[model samples]
Target: MVLTDTHTHLYYETDAEKQDLLFQRCFENKVNRLFLPNVDVSSIAKIDALVEKYPDNCFAMAGLHPCDVKEDYEILLKEIYQSMAGKKIYAIGEIGIDLYWDKSTLDIQQTAFREQIKWAKAAKLPIVIHCREAFDEVFEILEEEKADDLRGILHCFTGNLEQANHAIALGFYLGIGGVVTYKKAGLDEVLSHISLDNLVLETDSPYLAPVPFRGKPNESSYLVYIAQKVADIYHISIEEVAAITTANSKKIFNV
Candidate 1:
């Protein structure tokens, strides 16, 4: 039963010193692959270093996070493109609109999102999207940019069934994470209409830890709890969930 954490921020300053111990814990728990998504230009070097440290176990994606979008976004976008020119990035990720924090840069966020979508299409890499309270805004850009060639995952997905179906129709997989285990989280509604094949497990750690570890710092090993929650929601075995989602991750990331 090999579990793959399709999205995480192991490169964050908080996790810098715990890499070896984290990998050891994940190894013990049968968590084989850890996909790290870049936050912005500032964290690119740190992310590359982390990937270099555990090249086999850790893979990386390059992109400008939505929240990082500002007036000078073009400069950052150029940096993102140059950084990924010939790199082995698994996805052009952690990108999309995030209105939860500040709506002031909504315009810039949308522009950055569309531009990165073009980047993803040109690079032939899947995208890892991050949408907050801006589902409508995110979908609007996706509808405009998502052609027959564009595809990716909706990282940290928390939308309703309609949004889930909309994303799936465009050939994107739903990135299930720790939020699914929340007591009142209505993610099961979305899961009820979506099949496991179109679903992939993630932790988005060290951020959204699952129940029992909820409110605590999350790690790759905690993905097992997420897998268990998914199995319960889908009414299947944990091994089956792990197998299918791991395969889904590989299929999208081409790992």
Candidate 2:
């Protein structure tokens, strides 16, 4: 079975030997595809290097993460937007409003999010969103920017069934991650009512590790745990989850 991690930060692992082992574990687990989303300007090079090293398995995206938005963000964001000039990218994200970290930056975050959305729309690329405790805020912007071609994955989605449906209505696939395996995350319950067609799998790794590795650093190899949890929810085999979600990833990333 070929599994796909629709969103991951595995490129953050810089050691050559260690990064190889990480890819080994991912491949050994049948997690054959990984999409890397740049969190800030600095991550562009890291992501480019990894994708260049593993062109067959890794894809890259560019965007300034909401949490990274700050005063003087316009200048930095311009740099990020321009960084996409010579590189090939599948999306313009991990961008969206994140109210959990700092409500103070909400205004700038929204502006950054909208500008990135414009970038994606102009490029005709899908957007991988990074919504966190700001569904209402994010949805408002998405609603405003909603267009026939406005489609992508909502990375690391942890919302209720209503929000899931709302996102689907707005032309987005909900990105299910390690949180689905958490006992109290309620994501599994939410997935019970959402079809595989409207869903995709992710690890968001080096973060949100699944059970058995919940409190530890996450990696793409652990995507199986999240897939298994999703399989259990949908009453299907892990292979089916892999097949469907990987297909969903290809539909989103065109890879």
Candidate 3:
């Protein structure tokens, strides 16, 4: 029952003092191996600090978030590269097209996504993608970039089966989150066609908390609930889902 949360924002307003209790709870539930994704320049310091504090438990990735892409993107991207320079960034991520908030940055977002993909290839690190209401746009950039040397996970995947298949075809893993536990999410249909080998479990903590605590701030300890729901959906034991997805995560992040 060792569950690995492949994606989470552990550095998101999470205090270092509370980390001990958080680790205790997660370890008690066999949830370890947390990966942190950097949103923008503002997050780089905090993310680095967290990783430094828990190098064994928390791993980090560096990239500019899509929502942060704007006129000042060039300056921010330079800062991102500076932070990642000579550092072992687990991935280039939380990066992709996000049309939900601001569509004005569509062109810049696409450029940033492609640039990050190039960096991922050069750095030889997997990417943790963030896509929302922009699958076609994201997929279009990914295809044009031809990221053959790049591979990663689609964090908080809300796409249909066809999108999942396309991502898989491009050597990416689907990141299943608390949304899957929602009865109305329609994730079960996508899960039916996605094998466990191509899936990884995540909580995206402080965000998508699973059912029974659906509206509360999420924690890594709640990853068990997400795993349980996935197991129930696939008609498999919780332990099986934990082991398989943990292995899948390790295989990708090389942890």
Q: Which candidate ranks first by lDDT, i.e. highest?
A: 2
Residue 204 of candidate 3: its Cα lDDT? Answer: 94
lDDT of 2 by residue, 127-218 (tens): 99989899999999999999998999999999999999999999999998888888998888888888998999999999999998989999
Instruction: Report the lDDT tens digits of candidate 1 across residue range 1-255.
Output: 999999988676445457778878888988999998988897788878878878888888988998889888899989978988666898998899998999999988988888888888987889999999998998888887868778889999988998899889989999999999998999987798889999998999889899989999898899999999999988999999999999999999898
Pick the winner on lDDT between candidates 1 and 2. 2
Clashing pairs in 2: none
Q: How well does model 1 score by local distance difference test?
A: 0.88
- List the lowest-lDDT window of 10 residues for candidate 1: 10-19
Return the TM-score for candidate 3, rounded to 2 decimals. Answer: 0.96
Weakest 10 consecutive residues of candidate 3 by summed lDDT: 10-19
Candidate 3 segments whose C-alpha is farther than 4 A from its true place:
none
**C-alpha lDDT values of all predictions:** 0.88, 0.92, 0.89
> On a 0 to 100 scale, what is the lDDT of residue 176 in model 1?
92
lDDT of 3 at 223: 96
Candidate 3: residue 43 lDDT (0-100): 90
